[model samples]
Target: MRRQVLFVGLICVTFLVNAQEEKTIDLDEVTIQASSIIRKKDRQLIFPSKDQVRRSMDGLDLTRRMSLPRLWVDPNTKSISMANGNVQLRINGVLASSLEVAALSPEDIKRVEYHDNPGLRYGEGVDIVLDYITIKRTSGGNLGVDLSHQLNTFWRADYIYGKYNRGRSEFSLSSFANGHRYKEAWQDRTEIFHTPDGTFQRTQEGISGRDYEMYWTTTANYNYTKDDDYFLNAKLNFYYYDYPHNYSSALLRNSESKMTTDLIDNNKSLNTRPSLDLYYFRKLPRKQSLAVNVVGTYSNTDSRHTYREELESIPLTDIYTKVDGKRYYPLVIGIPCAM
Candidate 1:
């Protein structure tokens, strides 16, 4: 009886790569030695389809959901960066991270499976060194509310909200209010060349473009499962970054004649990016599925740089006595003249 079943199975897979040659994978060599597990699954594992899975899961009302810790992925990549330990990632004729993967709905997902373990069947041939999770794919999220004060240098507040389902969904939102005090400055140095006759011929000046930054993120999400009944999977995220700076100092020529007094300058800039994601999934029985996901993002940034310098002469001390002058203008120096 067993030989007859095997013969039929072989016929189904007759398109073997090396048909002309014969090779056999010894059962002992193919076995993983985990006898207890092999026996346990053959007798208990269940591959439930949608109708059956929903029926089983619906047992728990919407009031409460099951929670299982699973790896979280970047969504776009089939890469799982985290795992809850057991690492059940693959099986005979089955693969993990397949496009038709069953997701209950962002809201129904009780737990996600994430196994970076090289021991995973899918990674048995992968090098052991490249198997760790990334910061973005970590499997932990929580909620918290914070109060902030911006009346001083170290004043700020934050709030957090997060959640994830075992089968289909995840969500989170966070915001921060802040106030900061800062001081920044710029410096310029110049060298001039002159002949034995004195005066000047050319100049070389160095200007440093510099600044400081501060910002925060405010965002939210609502992802749906890989189920057909749930047509839309949605997501949204936003962030705003800000920077304010102040600088001083610019070279005054005949520099030897100037006291090189101090100067003050100020500038401010802001940047923001907003993005939204939506997708659709359709499943066909016989283990086939298709999905279409779309993403939209927009970003805007503005910058302002202000710089100026002041020069004051020291007592007539004959030094640079040949020249003396104070420059007080919008300090706007337009394009330089070649001559």
Candidate 2:
């Protein structure tokens, strides 16, 4: 009985030792894995969250939060451009413009991502990629206004309004107006010499008496989504511009002849653009999806330019130029399988 007792004790001791050894080995493995995970995380760049974005005022403010030196956002145009200028803008996986981004509010953004080197899937000449993910709002709207004045008599103003609902529909409207004036002065000298003809010398001084420009644009967008699988969007834009210029010059020839000339130029343009986009997605059996996209755009433009010139010794003449045209573009794409 004594020997059996001793054997049982020995077996229990051995089991305990083995169990402790296994536990120690597992702890070491887990430590290594945890250290590796930390290292991996340290190597990756962290993007901003929606909460952080909500604290910002507009897209420019959000860009400033990126903390990247190579990224820049123009305060006037509201355009984001990288250092290399090889970047593309997309909204919800659709091609977009800088104007659209400028109109976005911080609360509308979910996150922002930056890729120094993009893959072939993004197309060519894409050295960098910046993605602005938008939040899915339940039902809300936002309004924005931007105004600025410069020391050199330059000024700009913009206004935007957007709204969305939880019922798979959204709409937005934006308008912009800008105007500026500038003064300029210049001098020109000309000398002409011919073998048989006498030499001629001329000097002219010029100044811009009036230079002014005004521009306006209005844009509207409508979007619809169904069950997160289908999407439809429509956009319309209207634009107008007015420019007028006046100049006067004093001319001296042969040091004894003097003349004066006046010039006037006026231009006006109007444009309209409408676009439609559609998307359909199908889920496959093995965690896959098929997507189809179609896009169409139509544009019309009307422009008129007029110039009038009057010389001291010549008759006043007026020249007019006009342009009127329309264009259309259509695009279709399909993806059979996407993982």
Candidate 3:
């Protein structure tokens, strides 16, 4: 009986110890699973997440990371470009310019994706695409200025502001202005021959006294998200430009006697453009999404030219031309894909 009691107690103790060990193992597994879940939430491939790339660099830094041989940045404009053509930049899947990218800070970015082979929807000659996914911050802003001087002068200033709420709503506004002045000179020679008339030659020398330009642009964007499944974005843009040029030309013709013509030309032009874009996105199960975009643009141009000429020291004639035009463009695109 004593030996049986001792054996029973040993069996009970072993059972209790085994149960405790199993419980501890289960707790450890739960903790590991929770940590893995957290890690998964912190890292995402398609969108901006708390990753090394995002935490360490800004949008411009990300662009430099491409290390493409053909990629280059314009110091004067502070814009990035590829050798083939302009680099397509998209912010949250909406068309954006390099200036917009420069305005973004690292904290504002969620992810940067470089696409060498863009989808057919992106059109032809699109060798590269840089897409920026942005995070929703409570409030943020950026300011930038670029200045260059040589024979001509160039300068630009820009500002951007953004606001976001925990309820999945975001708003941003950006504005930029630039000015330029250029000087140019050229010479032209022409020879004329006729069956009945003798051959003659003409030489013309001209200089653009002044070439001035000014440009301004403003953009406003709004985004709304519902349950991480449906998203809507709206953007409005306005642009304006003014350009003026002055020219003086001296001409000599080898006729019976040397004939001289003095000319003055003046040209002024103005352009205005306004655009609106609407984007919609719907997320489906299994990590798929559908997107639709609509864009509308309206542009207006006004130009005027004045020309005055004197032939052989005599007043010849004066000409004036004025033109005004308007254009409208509408575009729509839809894409559905799995992530």
- Order the candidate numbers by lDDT, best to worst: 3, 2, 1
TM-score of each: 0.38, 0.62, 0.66
User: Candidate 2 — which pairs collide?
Assistant: none
RMSD of each: 24.1, 21.9, 21.8
At residue 69, give the lDDT of candidate 3: 43
lDDT tens digits, residues 57-76, model 1? Answer: 12111112222224343322
- Candidate 1 lands at a TM-score of 0.38
Number of residue pairs clashing in candidate 2, backbone atoms closer than 3 angstroms, sequence gap of 3 or more or interchain: 0
Which tens-of-lDDT digit does each residue in 267-332 have in candidate 3? 889999999999999997899999998999999999999887787667788899999999999999
TM-score of 2: 0.62
Writing each residue's lDDT as its tens digit, candidate 2 over 210-311 gives 455677777677777665566666666666665544333434344434655554455666666666666666667777777777878777877887766567
Each candidate: what lDDT? Answer: 0.37, 0.59, 0.62
Off by over 4 Å in 3: 1-58, 61-67, 136-167, 181-202, 226-228, 248-257, 285-288, 306-310, 313-321, 334-339
Query: Local error of candidate 1 at 164, Å?
Result: 8.3
Better of 1 and 3 by lDDT: 3
Clashes of 1: 22
